[model samples]
Target: MALDTAKKSQIIAKFARKSGDTGSTEVQIALLTARISELTEHLKINKKDFSSRLGLLKLVGQRKRLLRYLKATKYDTYAKVVSELGLRDK
Candidate 1:
């Protein structure tokens, strides 16, 4: 129905950091990624959900921009995230 547990935990851990992570980029990106995945499944059964589709697209764009930022500032972290999220490599 949704992404696997290991991947979900990885994203959740990044988003819910222990300390010194207030308004952190990783947290923001992870949260957006989770939303995107949620909306994806929602749209799967409700294929006629235009509004949800729009929201999903927006989240995907947000995540894409965040990935670009991560790649620019921290390539390794970006790679790890994309791989965990199963996003495209290039």
Candidate 2:
């Protein structure tokens, strides 16, 4: 269950820093978060979906790395993204 193009576009538009910033850290984290949420729901319905669970773990790892990089390089944008996404303990 992948995100549709329209929803993906919405996330990109919300997190994009510039006009064509699809691959920026914030956009990437948002996209990954969306996918992770979708997979989480799927896992809740299909409890035996181990492959989807593994994929969810991978997506979470990727998002974590991206967030780490953003926090190290741009704290303000990272904070904004975290707040917008409601991520982390903060």
Candidate 3:
């Protein structure tokens, strides 16, 4: 599934402007969350798709790294992103 281009661009723009800007954390998390959700739905439809599964794992790893970075650099931003994206308890 394709991402919402406008929204994805907005996140990339924000991150580009300021790497440490916490304002974009929610957007980043939201985009990743959406991707994860989409991949999950696809997996349900094609249970034998190993390539997609690998991609999903890679995305999850990337998201986890971003989350860890946010947590280490700015705990508040990490918490806010986590809450907004409902990514906890996973």
Q: Quick one: best lDDT, which candidate? A: 2
Clashing pairs in 1: none
Order of the predicted models by TM-score, top scorer first: 2, 3, 1
lDDT sort, best first: 2, 1, 3
Q: Per-residue alpha-carbon lDDT of model 2 for 11-69, expressed as tens digits?
A: 99888888889999889999999999899999999999999999999999999999999
The segments of candidate 3 whose C-alpha lies over 4 angstroms from its true place after superposition are 6-26
lDDT of 3 by residue, 1-90 (tens): 667878667656544436555356555666777788899999999999999999899889888887888798998877866875667834
User: Which predicted model would earn the best TM-score?
Assistant: 2
Task: Summarize candidate 1's per-residue lDDT along 5-45 as a digit string, tens digits.
Answer: 78766666766547556456677777677778778888888
TM-score of each: 0.73, 0.95, 0.74
List per-prediction Cα lDDT, in the order shown: 0.75, 0.91, 0.75
